[model samples]
Target: MGDILLRVSSSIKTLIPFRSVCKSWYQVLSDPYFTRNLSLLISNDYSGKTYLVQVEKDLISSPTSYSMKDDIDCSSGCPIGSCHGLLCFERNNSETYIVNPVLGSDDDLVIMLPSMNTETEVPSLFPVRIFNLMGFGFCPNTNQYKVVRTIRSTLRVYIYTLGTDDSWREIEDLPTDRFTSCLPGVYLNGALHWLTYPRIESDDRKLEIYCFDVETEKSHQLDLLPQLLQGRNNLDGLKLGVLDNCLALYIKLGGCFSNFDIWVMKDEKCWANIFRISGVAPLSVWNRDRVEPLMLTEDGNSLIAYAEEDDERRLLKHFDVRTGKNITNRTLIEKGTITSGRRYTAHVATLMSPKHIMKRSTCHV
Candidate 1:
């Protein structure tokens, strides 16, 4: 009975209802060991199939819509990060939230972070500052979900524990003098990874990888493969993402180069060039516009790229990385349609409950 239910709980949709069968079932499902194992199972079972969540006018009603607010200010608000079945959104550089879109409800699980502008007795400049980087990740050691916000102007970083009364706590300043990229951080292996530029300017501005541990709340630099930085003078036209459970770098070449190179960090020290798409398909079809790599298919053979046909239209195209051939392309949205916002990332559904994760907090507010 319990074992059978656990086996079928690979899908979050099924796990949700199974927990409500009775008190005993709920207890069994809520066990930390059970939840951890279930999360791993879910991750393995659904490694492919990334969702392109569009923020539309009627966000609550649209299946593709993930924005919590129907009238959210898209100019100021955007999906900053996703982790452990939760999405973090920031608005006007002050308001932040963590939401589970699959749950389809904002009543209990939705965490509204304290205003980034709130004043304190010793407040110096944060009240007048704006955060440029935000990320969300789960700390497996603490069994907690945390939101990390960085104020690039001041080199200040703050961490907020979800589902707790604890307010935001400022962490140590980033070691690097320069700020992070406009792109969101990639959460993997209990850490949030970002590409950052150095403060001291050079003829050729190089970028470094910075990672923050969710549990330790510490920041460190990650060395890149020498091959990755050989010809690249700057970080422009490069994006960071997770592929096959590892950190991946998508480098888009320019000036007569049509295809982008995909490099995966095999370990902390080694990078492997897993895929390179060259020739006609992408270069000819996409022209010079940027084509963002969303995610690889479950089979790991095909890769999906998002391309903008024009200001009014966008399309998602699949390519066979092995043969550098275009597999298929589909219209992402219609023309002249104003969605609440548009963002894409790799997502993995999990049965880990936020309420349960934050239930045994030992830290004081």
Candidate 2:
């Protein structure tokens, strides 16, 4: 029964209320693995996920109305990424924070990360990563969570392990400084992959992506490209996101019209066409305005997306993925919330204590 309660609970908010139902509910919530398992469940389900609206003061952030029950007052931080129920915040250009929103509305759950370098914020080469190349990932092997950042101009990589490392440690830099800030650090299979900058020096045969393993702390390359991408106008449409806890590549490909095909990476090597949309939906276009629900739904037939209008306004849109059929479209996300400089991503509130990831008696970094 304890295991069943753990499985059925969607979010930390939902799971907590069940504690009053029975002792089994309380025990499940109290388990040391509760937050960790809850984070895993959210990744697997992807239904109760919240699209972060913006980060306010104290690194406290706001999610869409669907997920905004807790009014947290935080400031001076921008979102880096979200992983395992923790929101990564970049503040003051150098310091990073790991915050667990499920814990409550105060700064008690905030874990201040060590400064990477004295380097100031890199100027905006493109829209994203005006700060730096940053990502947050979970290593399932050792049950560890790590934050990875790369100095924008130098291409040098640094890593910080929660519950273990007291300071940020430098790692080997990428072979080339050319990397796309489009989809910064895409976490998958205990590793983070960064899409290389397209068409460097006009050498455009095919660009391979850079992969860094969290557990191994080493970098490698993955040739996970499809033949359709060889002659595409812009590689921006070919986006990478997590679906069913796997690396999913969705791009506009040839069909009767421009069709969007979602390919999932299997065994870390092969790509399988698991979902296909008959026509391109405007919301599915990936560009400066990051699209929410980045991929197809679990059923592989529908996608809930945010459509950007001509007046530079975004609207909540629901439509069929395969046929470009519109179900409904309206303004769901609040106005003035999803703005520039704020990185909006999906979030699942978790009770996972940020301190629990620490390995030492005291945090030095």
Candidate 3:
């Protein structure tokens, strides 16, 4: 019986559906040992027409057996927040809910603003036009959760703590010129970073970054790096991620091939030009003119841009901070024909090896 339990433990998530095998099996499945190893994987349906997929990692390796399951139903305007093993999802009408699909739990959070909903219409003022730019993070110091929503470049910041009667409290209304289009906000080092493109009437295109601190609930500007300022069109690029915990901006410069330049913030007021990958090489080709394509891998270590070669679709892959490359022809995912043109979103995670999970249990037991 213990041997059977051990085998079940190796794939706890996959074995969950088969817990009715016997009483003893049920006991083993309900044990803390099994639940502790369960990993929650989440990805959004960019069209907001389908429910997000939340699957247990234990079953993912055996893709044939572990089919990905939809965990949460999402609307067009709902913003998502991920922390620990749960997601903070809020509708445009201010209906907030904390859901942990893996645990089959959904907790309704109270409204953050006191009289705003009844006194003034939220949609009229702060409409949910774009869901991609909303920023959500957990603050350990306050034992609370925070969300940042931008409306046509203006920012509305909200925070919610556990055991608090209020759902979200609006801290401030940020100016409109500080927010960028299609760029996502990242929460790191107690602050939220947003990429913005500000242009004056007679001034050249001044690309800037706006940062908001969760502690102080204040917004400040970080100095643009020289290389970032020199880029042909920084706004045309996409927000990659933070390198070494600093904000990393990926600029797409179009020439004979697509130019990818990475700029990292060196200091609060300064930035450093980190790396640049130019031209389509034997390993990786830049898709200079592709529509609705460009993927950041699950680990954030690789960038996959869709390109074409000899009438066949290919993906130009760059790994290890955009160095060491390969052109994989296999399609990670393929979708056809959609209704409304929604913002492009990517959600992927590295699937752990079953051998690694076995080793983890051996060390624990």
Candidate 4:
């Protein structure tokens, strides 16, 4: 029976009912080893749903959507980060939640994480500077779930370990004015990757891809940041994504930003060029400025990308690597489904319970 559970562990949603049927079954499914394996979800046969978000005009609720499943609305904004099928959301600039949208409306679905920005910190006009540089990831070394929040207003870093730390604890060595984008860092191989803010010292100085190892809690930079080192448009050329569990870069060449080149990191510094898409590579007038590659599909043929339109709207597109034309209905997530500007984290469905992942409870049935 335990062997049967292990065999079906990959489809976590199927195991949820059995965990309640017997004590021994619950023990096996809840084992850290079982849940930890889910963290390595990226695979060649990847069929995980890529959830998008549409933040309501009232700023009240952001409905999480996937091209596959449009009705999966959760509590708050688009994900701050995603790992092992759980998506984290920030609400009202104060409350945060880690939710499994697959378990929609279930009693044990959302985990309300403790707030990091409280009102009592030495009052200044801008008392809340340390918001937005937040991310959620899985640390393989410990088989633990962690959220790393970098204070954008200041140079401090704080980390929260679920099922362990109830509060956000400060960590050292955070980069000042780096980790610029409020969007969650792309998680791959136990680390989060983000393109740093462009350097202004020289025209040749391009943006660097920064990485933070979730296990060690240390930060570093990646090499050959897929762009021409000397062009004025260099810094804006590269965008990040994860393909086959590896970090991938989408480079938009030329001034009009039409020609595209995709590369995936084989190691810390080694990048292997994967594709080059030419002519109308989904860089429409609406989605030119804000576009990102989501991932390489399971078949290893085309790439799926996310783009925000002109007026805080969003779209997801797929382009053939060889042709570079928009294959709107050819891929898994065919349409962008018109969304808000909120960052949409790639989501997969799983039954990782907050009760098992967090030490404390605010996630009630």
Candidate 5:
């Protein structure tokens, strides 16, 4: 019946929840044909009015021409990740919503989490804090969407499993004194890697990289690049990312004029360098705010940074990751003071979409 339905129509195939139909139906849904069709449907549903900004690139940003007149309230927050063209987002108030922008299919899945203060599910009293630094990744092994959130100062690990009806589960506690706010959590090698500030008072300046295995729920201490750790005398200045599939650490050195260095770890060896920004009068002009999300562009060859340029404007800067140079400088959108606090969203695709590939292919034409 599943195969017959799949042969009859793509629309009807999506109506049946493959995971719930049967083992055979699940296998059929995971088939290449079904998945590809699903991706196309998802892509078409999101391409309109929603766009991913290529930060760190030189592209002229257009002014906001269309307004959200209907005002489908997304005040909870904006959607960030899109899988099969379905966007996952949380409102500013932690109300989760999955929307297909093209199809206009917006489903709100609100789940209440335990409050740190009361430790109980209170109605309309305690608000759930949305950890922006938390990593969102889809686990294929478990066929589950896992959201890993680290409590700001305490290193408390909370995993929100989508399959478990978005229930919050408190995992093993890490060693105390782990201070991470807006810290990036890198998912690599089937584990979540984060820079941790160890508990030892004497080695307060020392920064340790810790890895939490998603499969085993175990934590292991990773060796920090000695060159990077040595310079991290102050905890507030270190930045983290993955460069060329390896751990990349950026350290801010304080002086009369500030200096920042980038270190990449490969096969347990660390390569360090100080990046120079061209067209800048003085290198000191590059402040801590200059570094952004460091995202991969639609082309995957370039890295993008989206940040605010002024009170009235936002800037998207693009860079070539291979050469460590700027490619394009584009502003995504600029708005007046009245719309200053409004949020915008971008989707990060794990699997390259054919539509995106074709869209990029047209660039040369």
Candidate 6:
């Protein structure tokens, strides 16, 4: 029975129910060895799928059109980060949640995070303000899932371990200058990476990557490629994502130039310009300055993107990386307005449970 279940673990849909069959089956599915092998198999064999989470204008309810029937309603918050099929949301700027939206019929597993006092005093007219950036990721070394948050005003960082009694532990301070964007962090290679700018004293203002290792609770910086640094003024047009298990940067060259460039990090210090799409209409027509690279196609030939036009129409396009052309005529999403805080990211469902991975210590009061 265990061997049969292992064979079917490749499909996320099948693996979910398999764990519910019996106590022994649940244990087998949650085994560390089985979880690691299953993740690799899905990455190699599964064709990636993209889903859009739309937060209503009310800023409370969010209905996701992930599938025809999968509806996620968080009346208090908006989703900000996605990792390993778990969605992390920030509600009222004071609390957070980690939820698995695809667990059909079985009530959604929602983990409410303990509130933290992030308020700090600024010199402005409004003396007290709160600025926070949060990220969610899985740490393999400890087999635990963690949420990392950085308070911008004080540069203080806090980490919350899922299924553990630890509320939020203060970690090392962020070493970089104030991060320019409030964007969610991208999880890759057991770390969370965010785009940030250097301090005002520095002459070069081009954006750099700020990476935080989940296991070590440490921070590092990755410099931008020479080509990107040349156009420092256009930093707002840049976005980051993962492609083929590597870090990728998507930059839209606006104005008369109607195309965008995709650069993939080949090594720690090397970046390869993989694709350049020319004659892209959405680049010129979009009210938003940047377009996000969602995922690489199954065959690894085309790249999927999400962009918004001047009229606020959201578009999902498929660009053939090899030919640098928009090959697909069909629009994945039409006449849809993406909500302000709602995020759409690549999610591959898995049976790896946070409860099983997180080690319990003392309970929080």
Query: lDDT for every model?
Result: 0.59, 0.56, 0.45, 0.57, 0.44, 0.58
Error of 6 at 192 (Å): 1.0
Query: What tens digits encode model 6's per-residue C-alpha lDDT throughout 1-365?
Result: 65666555434455767677788887776554453322210000011122323211111121232122234456555455767656676666568776655452233356677986666523233211223457888776666678876544455567887766457887765543354455678898798887776445456666678888887888888988766653335555677788888998877755644777889898779999999877543232234533556666656777766654434455555678788777642233322333433334566544555443444312321
Worst 10 residues of 1 by lDDT: 40-49
lDDT of 2 by residue, 184-228 (tens): 577776888775554344646455667888788877877756575
Model 1 global lDDT (CA atoms, 0 to 1): 0.59
Better of 4 and 5 by TM-score: 4
Cα-based RMSD of the predictions, in order? 7.8, 7.5, 9.1, 8.5, 10.9, 8.0
User: What is candidate 6's local distance difference test score?
Assistant: 0.58
* Residue-level lDDT tens digits of model 5 in 198-311: 434564456677776665666777777665544224545565665445666666555533544556677554565534333321111233234443545434666554444555
**Local error of candidate 4 at residue 259 (angstroms):** 0.9
TM-score of each: 0.72, 0.71, 0.60, 0.70, 0.56, 0.74
lDDT of 1 by residue, 1-365 (tens): 65776555434455777778898887776554453322110010011211323321111222331222222122345566877666677765578876555453345765667887533323334322322567888787876778887643455667888766457787774543555556678998999898776644465555678888888888888876565452223465567888778999887655554567889998888888888776312222224344667666646677766665566566556778787677766555432333323444556544445555555554522
Clash statistics: count for each candidate:
3, 9, 3, 4, 17, 0
Local error of candidate 1 at residue 277 (angstroms) = 2.1
Instruction: In candidate 4, list every pair of residues with a backbone clash.
Output: 107-365, 163-358, 163-359, 316-336
Candidate 5 error regions (>4 Å): 1-105, 108-118, 121-133, 150-156, 173-176, 229-233, 243-245, 255-260, 268-289, 296-303, 307-313, 319-327, 336-347, 350-365
Best lDDT goes to which candidate?
1
- lDDT of candidate 3 over 63-159, digit per residue (tens): 3222234444555435444433344455553555544444343234222222224334243344323323456554545544455553332345455
How displaced is residue 207 in candidate 4, in Å? 1.3
Candidate 2 regions with alpha-carbon error over 4 angstroms: 1-14, 17-27, 30-76, 119-132, 173-176, 198-200, 226-233, 253-257, 278-292, 295-301, 309-344, 359-365
Report the Cα lDDT for residue 114, model 6.
90
- Number of clashes found in candidate 6: 0
